[model samples]
Target chain A: MARILVTDDSTFIRRRTCTILNRTGHEIIEATNGNHCLEIMQQDKPDLLFLDLVMPGLDGFGVLKTLQDAGNTIPVIVLTADIQDAVRDECMQLGAHTFLNKPPAEAAVLAALTDALAEGERKA
Target chain B: MTSAAHSSSTRQLNVLQKDAITELMNIGVGHAASTLHTLIGHKIELVVPEVSLITLDDYHQLQPYEADELLSTIWMGFRGGFEGNTSLIFPTDSANTLITALTGEMDDSPELDELRAGTLAEVGNILLNGVMGSIANMLNAALSYTVPEYMECSLLNIFRKNHTGNDTIMLARTTFAINELKVEGNILLFFKVASFEQLLISIDRELAI
Candidate 1:
């Protein structure tokens, strides 16, 4: 099982997402917002991240840009409730492994986890 | 009344200001829809078709509902580069429809009645924060939101509570819908007069960038 970090401002959303991922046997870490997520990343170095886009300080875009600039290669799966093709394209350009709508389905979550881990293994 | 007149005199938002507010709201609504998707397990869509600077009085004239119409309202306050109130307003039926769609259950249960208030608060909390957070980010400002409160009241009472003399509300007329469920609701953003001026300055700065 891979180490995954879930980041969002809402306590309810964070816990629900963690519960979903827990059933898949993955270890889950929680961050309240973007700044917290970044701090945790440095210490824990999780294999993948599930990030919320609209947060108080340092949104998901800010976090993604920072990671790219620092040459960090940890896979990021943007899980946001934001709309449009433009945002998806922008996240991919910034090196997000994939984008999924918030409250993703159990199957979709599992599939994304598999794909991200497989790709990480390939890179290694 | 004097403050309202004063605010009205300078209420016109320039092209740059309007665009900035529109873009910020567009980003915010998108995030709100994403949160809704998680609750319902279905993709949701919200669109802000118009962002206009209008005084509360002018808005009253254009409002679609009667003064006594029941509204499902969630209100919250935000402070950052500026301070203001944001709300999710829906006709009672629309709110019930949305709750039903999200929970996939009828509203007949007594438990459902209690859940209704909490459910709407959660929904509004996600949506309002999304909008304000986007606007703050675009302006490079830090915004913290108050805990959301849910209320069932007449449209007029809702407006009265939000209005304080001459507040220049940023009326971002929004349509939130889930195409699958055919449920739709409306949202509004209200920025107080002084808070709005600060926003305009921030928007101008963003435009310069």
Candidate 2:
């Protein structure tokens, strides 16, 4: 089972995401915001990161940029409520494996998890 | 007050009707909070603390806000399965605070300039669309919406200017806290008597299903 890090400022969204991921038998690590997410990344280095955009004090974009600058190749799947095409394009350009809208559906979450994990294995 | 206004003011919704509408509004507001959370990156807590059907006359009597207090309002007109105009209203100071919080602007000036007004409009657009979209989706109804407009005016003037003879108002009192900043606003939906009936019918149909 892969260890997944779920980061979001929202308790509801975070809990909902974790609940869905838990059913898949993946180990889940929770981070309240971006800084917390980065700290956890350095300490734990989870298998996959479920990132949220628009977090206070260092956001998803900042995390992606930091990781890129440091040459970290951790797979990230961005979950956001912002439906703007521009936002999606930016995340994709920043190396997000996929972009999923918030209030995430169970099927989509599982599908993304499977695909991202597979891609990571392929790269390894 | 006109006869229509008087009639609407006296009409009372039964407990079931009131509860159903209130619950639906809560769901809409919850969705709005989720969207707002993504926009500002702050954890947003939104509660439709109260939902009431009243008339412009009743609103005037209740005087929720100071009569002359300046308010930042974003309003839109909607039509289709049901027709009405809805607006999100916040006291000018609260609006400024909210804008500053979202934009991280140092200026706390009371005046809402063109740029700030535009920013507030975008925020309101996200919220109002969230509410309207969720409600419409739940009811499986089609709706056409007008371009949203932003206005800075007194609370009294807001209703006076938009007073469209239809007196029945569905007021959803929304309170949201973004991080440490708490802002309270009212979402007023003005519907004609017939349109209000149509909404209730739609709700009943949903309940039946």
> In TM-score terms, which candidate is top?
1
Candidate 2 clashes: the total is 1
TM-scores of the candidates in the order shown: 0.63, 0.57
lDDT of 1 at B64: 72
B1-209 in candidate 2: lDDT tens per residue?
11122345556666676677777778877888877776566687665446566655555642467778778898877777777777788877678877777556667465536557756765676677677667777776666565567897776776665455646665545566664666666766666567778888998898888
Indicate the residue-level lDDT of B147 in model 1.
Answer: 62
| Least well predicted 10-residue stretch by lDDT in candidate 1 chain B | B1-10
What pairs collide in candidate 1? A81-B34, A82-B30
- lDDT by residue for model 1 (B81-148), tens: 78878778887877888877755568567866756676677678767766665666557676656667
lDDT (0-100) at residue A58 of candidate 1?
84
* Runs in model 1 lying further than 4 Å from the true structure: A1-124, B1-9, B41-48
Query: Could you give candidate 2's per-residue lDDT for residues A6-102 as a string of tens digits?
Result: 9986555676689899999989999978899999999998989999876668888889888878876778999865554556777898899989976
- Candidate 1 residue lDDT tens string, A5-118: 999876556766787899988889999789999999999989999998767788889999999999978889898644345567779999999888655667877888889988
- lDDT for model 1 comes to 0.74
Chain A only: TM-score of every candidate? 0.95, 0.97
